[model samples]
Target: MPAESRTAFSFNNSINPSTFILIGIPGLEEIHIWISIPLCSMYILTLVGNCTILFIITTEQSFHKPMYLFLSMLSIIDLIASTSTMPKILCLFWFNSREINFDACLVQMFFIHSFSIMESTVLLAMAFDRYIAICNPLRYTSILTNPRIAKIGMIAIIRGSVLMTPCPFLIKRLSYCGTNVISHTYCEHMAIVKIACTDTTINRAYGLFVALVVIGLDVLFITLSYFMIVRTVLSLSSKEARVKAFGTCGSHICVILISYVPALFSFFTHRFGQNVAPQVHIILANIYLFIPPMVNPIVYGVKTKEICHRVLRIFYQKH
Candidate 1:
């Protein structure tokens, strides 16, 4: 009856598991050539930016601090998140290779969601580091040692892997006889699961549960940490000290907003905005997941003065 339903119905019946065609950014097939330019630019920038941050943090002993440790972790997570989807997306756009194997699809979904969760977890660690630095300056160094930060990073990896390990199995159990055509460029869990001919009650339920459990707890802790940081900053005796303390938080605050706001909006849109155009949903999904990775390094580049100074010094010396 409806056009969208009709389109879905056709694709639903076309799946055979030999290969699923990824429809990249629906309704823009004619202009995909134009689209690849911008997308490739972003991928290149993301790689360069995140790698540069990693290089600076690793090589410079001065950056051997808890805050920079979290920053380094964030860069690595961003790299993982982008690599999970962007290469395939770029392939789809550039070579017109829409066919992805079923196992590959499953792998993509796992990495994308897992690294996303890990990134949020890393953010929580960073928030706690800042809270301690600002609110308990006397004990910050004593408490947050290099070993402790490394442990935090290990925990983040474990948390993401363990939480998301069951997800691929959930989808793998489904019978996808109807259609294998994925609407988005990459294999998002919901997008892949939606093609299942069988009842998807379990898949949907488990996904929501994980989202709420993992992201929900991380957000709660981060919010509380910031709340305490703000309280501690405001009570400081010297105006200059208060300003400096808050300034340390400003970059992270911007990063949190950039990462969470779009992601939450995209998540809700997928769940609630069923009537929204499929193209809009796909585009927003890309923005939510990809934009942060592309822009985060840029944000930190401007926000962290030491990073900027070091980068400039290297360039000047090379010249």
Candidate 2:
């Protein structure tokens, strides 16, 4: 085929070229207006919910516990992750097909991955906290003291940020000789890397490696922590101790499942199930990215009684 014909064929094969396209479910445009309303509401709720969690944690003296510290870190990650993607999506829906520069896209991708990794790490840390609290309650205070918790939080942030730094740099090295249109809504690493005109073997390998490292390590550590926790709970002399331990870890587990399962689905879909409908893909993508933030505050508030009261107090005081 002639070069011009080849170019034309590639262009025709892809959905949109000028900008990233949001592949929604078939006939979704009919309900796009309605969908937009709820999605916008959720976006705002996610922001407020996470921000409120952060505020309460910062302001409330009683919430300075190790578990709440991890919750606060999760809230910060959720805030950054949700803000990194949603505002631009809302702009695209409301104003125009927003165009992101290459550098900006890279930056967005970096933060998205960074925050995601951090959330996962923070959850692992939370599991460790629960493990310490339940498995060795006698030393919980000594082991997870304020200064120690602060150190762990700092380590989580540093590790997550450093791990994701290579992603943007790797993406930058990839040549974009062809059209720059990204599929899906956000600057996701897989979606953007797919458009590289150069060989993307390294990109794919790196992505898979990073996913395995972050998700795999997190799941492993959490499972180990919970295993120890369960063993400890079972051996407890009183039923009350078991109940308390379970209660303390329940919210963290809920948040972990909410965040990790969707992420795994999206990762697998992008990696193995590319032929799926665009709308299905987009919906899963959005859920994978957004739901954690929206539900995080609720999980913490409902499960952790102190945070709930603190959040309510803040609202009541403001009014």
Candidate 3:
């Protein structure tokens, strides 16, 4: 019999309420301490940066506009998403605590994936906000009223929660007769599902479905929004007006690329890339979670004059 068959035959019975061992990075165990340095720094920066953004938005009444409201939502999502995984990861690296309760793992997985979906939707909403601001400045305020923005925020929360609600329950139904070692830092949906001894077609299919539908559709709409925005910008007669329109969009475009590129790469590698090393896969997964939350505030701080001015004002007052 094949090695795969032999391994399957060894653990035919299901084990309920298993404990999963998370190996920080499979091949890089020796450098786990060294690796913690940058990850820790990034996590700190993510907290400080996102908190600053939220503080600025909340205190400044001028920031009550749609654009800033969407940014505040994004900041909140980034805070929770990064916090959901980083603390446990740090513990794994520094204290060598690798064991996570199966139920806890499921909770982590749900929060991570759900918040990710919410972030994507918020990005899509931000794209729509840009589209209206540039394409129909006259109606921008009327179209994206406070109530409408509130509805968009509520929908993002509901859509993400509803879509990811099935993942943990689906995972619970499976039997983990095999070794319960998860090769990654956190309880990623597929990572947990892969250890199941039972048939996992439902979990796999549903995971793929959510990825394709949520990410696929959001990307499609964001692309179309930018396409229209570009067309409108070019139609403007003055060079300064065109420059201003594109300038407004430049930060958002950078943010979109930062958020999506690693995410797409990680998703494809998980589904394909059988030849890829485990360490690479695990590192990419960490990056997909870490980089966006860390980089978003920095990108916006540099590009947004209001945020920069507020920061400077805060510093000046302190001095």
Candidate 4:
């Protein structure tokens, strides 16, 4: 490859900061305009949707149960997750399309990862809630009472924040001698860490470990929760009870699958499938981050009839 191409390729590894303006994907710069419009619209809608969910669950007497409480927590996480990156991303498509300072980049990466970890943990909690409701209905109230639920939610948020703090701090310590252009829309941990001038052995290893610990543990717990849920549902005496239980969990399962499957695909592909097409990477990247927020409210509203009716009532009242 020519020197320019080589420079672009090695930008991630170089520690010396040469002043060069970062530009996004070629032939797709104009496309970002269109992308931004929809993204901004979606971000607004996500905020509104999630906020509505939270308000409904909090204020409604009917939604005082454990299930809606968990749903409210999930909505809060989704709102934060989407907010962490989408605003910066949309800004990049507009006036602030140039250099992102190293410090700002690190900040973005930290929140993005932190919120993602929180989202996963919240999903795991949701799974456990489902398991309790289905398998031990008599004790579901006692098991996931307000105090216990609040404690678990706090633990999830704190764990995610503490675990992801090191990633940005590690990235900050590394030298950036080369080009600073990040390939993707956001300052992702791996994408940013890969550019360090020093030996990123520790960073990469720690990142891999964090990814496995967070994603793996969440997946495992979610799977186990569902396994128990399925067993309980199957053992139910009436088909109606089984259907109701499954129906209650359907939105959660859909949201979980949508959020995690793409993430796993991106994770593995980034490691082992480097040679894959940039388009594939871009598509998966967008889907992994963006789609979940867009669909979360839809899933909840569709699968949970009460939330749906409440959301509709809110809309009607607004107009």
Candidate 5:
């Protein structure tokens, strides 16, 4: 909160320059080091786990199918999303270095939200993949070919990039007017927008719109996909067939829950949780970003037999 902590440039029309101070957690600065311990461990685990998944998917010819390709995409997004925020978070916690430039903050915000959208899109794609493989196995090979998967991946990237492109520009138009301390660890969208002294109605509306479009529509479609999948699965004559169908979806379901549950909690709390503690919001925000990346690979690695075998085979060979 000190003048020395902020590096603001003079603007001509009396607008406050864009600079922010990120207090890791508002009332818990004393335990930042303690907080960093588990966060750092999660980040390390995220890196190692996602990287291993990527390595296995890339190196193994057996993993060239649509499912594994989509898994690889998820791993990549998790890596980028967690990396975008975690290092700065660690810096804030470990070294008490919390000054982030406006442009830098915008870039961070862009990546965080963009990758979040990307992850959701990827999950939706995976749901579609599951729906196809379960409901229409005969067309599975013909439908999700490598080229079609590549297009889906490309569309996911472009959709996220295009939708989130306006966010930073919209934030740039707001007048900070010297109120620029963000309570959260990272440059979250609403967190940054809330500090602006000018009217943030447009920003708020657009933010909500984006959330509804990306998260809302995607969740709906994913649910619909699963609904059809379950219907088709139930209609299968043999119990073993039904069991196998459900078994294949277990890991994706787990990943989807971890990805969305914390995210929705943080999203709603940020806007609606007036009685909620600030620390709780901040902690859950970080958890939503960190937990998915850390858990996705573990979920898949354990649930997917091929990955488990290949991982064990590598360790066995190394040993």
Candidate 6:
């Protein structure tokens, strides 16, 4: 019994696992290069799209409102979340490189989880902005000023980090006995924990707590905001005004559903989809997490006239 093996829950009580092996798409090793091609395309698209949105919002005068400010925040989060895991996946798929250092896994888990939580929070903030604009137009400007939006962004980051900080340490405390192999493309919290040869009740409980309490609350508030928005929209006297207001929220609504539906589906499949294959679950989870980074900007660029005009102008000027 060494000093380091004194965890609250220990099974093997042996030495530390120096490295963990990452796995993806079981039984598809031979065609991984082919898989990497499409994945690389998606990753590139995610980066370029999010960066373009950020660029447009930062440089354009008309895009500096609260909605676009939150869009910028989301772009930043999407970039971090997508990049945090994609490079590792590319290596795993293209180069057959699966060995990741213990500390590196911790860092990856931290960034992936933190940004994910932050993105969800930002969506919640965006919902609040929409609610204010539609339901309480007079107070919207005062409530969601640049400074206030900045504070909200900062709070989202801080809250996400503070909650996810403990996850890695919890896994680090456990003794990994044999086969430090994680059955996922990247260092997800539960995927890494499954390799631990110790009682993982607390780890599982904490992860569930964050998912249910922190993220679930965000979903609840977003729903409430939209509910109030619809109520207010219906109350408006002019049909054209109502149509215009709903149209303004159309992109955000689509983005919200796109982000949440897949996420909630993948989450439930992981936890309770008894007959689903692990590969299918992993693919759904990856899509849930990564597609938004690529799709969100496109939705905004197409739905938002100002953003679309600026984007096309930039392209024309470049060409």
Which candidate wins on lDDT? 3
Steric collisions counted per model: 2, 2, 0, 7, 0, 0
| Model 5 lDDT tens row, 1-319 | 4542334333323355646888889989999999999999999999999999999999989899999999999999999999889999999999888888889999999999999999999999999999999999999999999999999999999999999999989998888775567889999999988878889999999999999998899999999999999999999999999999999999999999999999999989988998999999988998888999999999999999999999999999999
Best by TM-score: 5
Off by over 4 Å in 5: 1-18
Q: Model 4 misses residue 165 by how many Å?
A: 1.3
Quickly count the clashes in candidate 3: 0
lDDT of 5 at 154: 97
Q: Per-residue CA lDDT of candidate 1, range 1-319, in tens?
A: 7443444455554434656678888899778888888888988999999999999999999998999989999999999889888988988888888888778888888899999988998888989999999988899999999899999999989988998899888887787667667888799988988878988899999989988987788888899999998888888899999989998988888888998888888888888998899988888888888888888889888888899898899899999
User: Could you tell me which 10 consecutive residues in candidate 5 have the lowest summed lDDT?
Assistant: 4-13
How much is 71 displaced in model 6, in angstroms?
A: 0.4
Write down the lDDT of every candidate, Cα atoms only. 0.86, 0.78, 0.92, 0.78, 0.91, 0.86
List the RMSD of every prediction in angstroms. Answer: 3.3, 4.3, 3.7, 3.4, 1.9, 4.6
- Pick the winner on TM-score between candidates 1 and 4: 1
Collision pairs in model 2: 24-279, 25-279
| Residue range 56-175, candidate 6, lDDT tens digits | 888889788999999999999998888889999999998778878889989999998888889889999999999999998899889999889999999999999999999988888887
Inter-residue clash pairs, candidate 6: none
Which candidate, 3 or 5, would have the higher TM-score against the true structure?
A: 5
Candidate 2 runs further than 4 Å off: 1-32, 314-319
TM-score per candidate, chains pooled:
0.94, 0.88, 0.95, 0.90, 0.96, 0.94
For residues 1-319, write the lDDT of model 4, one tens digit per residue.
7343454566655554442233444447768777788778888888887887888888999998877877788788788778877877777788646566666777777877787888888888888888887788798887888899889889988988899888866776778776566667777777776656678898989988988998998999898888888888898899998888888889999999999999999888777887987556665776788888778888888788888888888789999
Q: Using alpha carbons, what is the TM-score of model 1?
A: 0.94
- The residue-level lDDT of candidate 5 at 164 comes to 96
